[model samples]
Target: MTFEAELRKGNFQVAECTNCKKTVWPPSDFCNQCFKEIHWRKCANEGKIIEFSKQNNYYFCLVEFENTIKVIGKISSGIPNKDQHVRIKRCGMTDDNYFFEFSLI
Candidate 1:
């Protein structure tokens, strides 16, 4: 399945190179390194918070998944801390931009 298509349906997906077996970030049709075809698969539901900040009452964090994909998402509830594990609460396209919400695990 295509990354954007699955993402729009609230299913997170990652692309891996068929030849190099390397994960591709930014969801491409081909691997950036070896230029091989990519295969799409479901990404890990859980990720680690790399960094976080509060804007007003909402917390936003940079989360890393499978040690490759990094996405910025908002904390759905509770306070967030660095290195905390989080799971995807919601994800979809909003307007032309991607939006993600996470809950602390």
Candidate 2:
């Protein structure tokens, strides 16, 4: 299945270049570097919190997965710290944007 299709099912997938073995961010059908075809694979569930901010009662953070894909998601519970490890608790499309919820690992 495609990226959007899989994401809609709460499965996070990444696009990787088959020839160069490099991950392509933003999920493309073709690799940006070699212009080769891409293959879809499940992304690592765990990520490191790059940065975070508190809004109202919730904490939102920028998390990096596989050292390549960075996404903004909300903390499911507890206060987050820099470079803290987190796991994807929930993810799916929200209207036109993607939404992710993370929990400390």
Candidate 3:
């Protein structure tokens, strides 16, 4: 149902550019940054949250991967930006996973 769930289940795939060195979280054939054909790789289910926003009872987090790829996800639990480290927590339910703008112990 959610984009993060889709990605975790492998229903949704992402792509990154090896040329201009950009990552496309939703996966695209063309690089939006360089306007070039994209060469992509599969991502492991891990990333760090760099930013977050709350709206209308919904929390959104911006997740950054190793290749500088950024994806937005939801925070199912914990306080944002309190730990000073960017981290994402994956739960078994997929829906329960929380992405935070800071790390947690």
Candidates ranked by TM-score: 2, 1, 3
After TM-score superposition, the amount by which residue 65's alpha carbon in candidate 1 deviates from its true location, in angstroms, is 0.6
TM-score for each of the candidates: 0.96, 0.97, 0.46
List per-prediction Cα lDDT, in the order shown.
0.93, 0.96, 0.56
C-alpha RMSD of candidate 2: 1.0
What are the runs in model 3 whose C-alpha is more than 4 Å off?
Answer: 1-9, 16-26, 30-40, 82-105
lDDT of 3: 0.56
Model 1, residue pairs in steric clash = none
Best by TM-score: 2
Model 2, 1-105: lDDT tens digits are: 488889999999999999999999988999999999999999999999999999999999999999999999999999999999999999999987899999998
TM-score attained by model 2: 0.97
User: What ranking emerges by lDDT with the best candidate at the front?
Assistant: 2, 1, 3
The TM-score obtained by model 3 is 0.46
Tens-digit lDDT track for model 1 on 5-53?
Answer: 8889998989999999999998899999999999988899999999999
Query: Which residue pairs collide in model 3, if any?
Result: 85-102, 85-103
lDDT, residue 10, candidate 2: 96
Kindly give the stretch of ten consecutive residues in candidate 1 with the minimal lDDT sum. Answer: 1-10
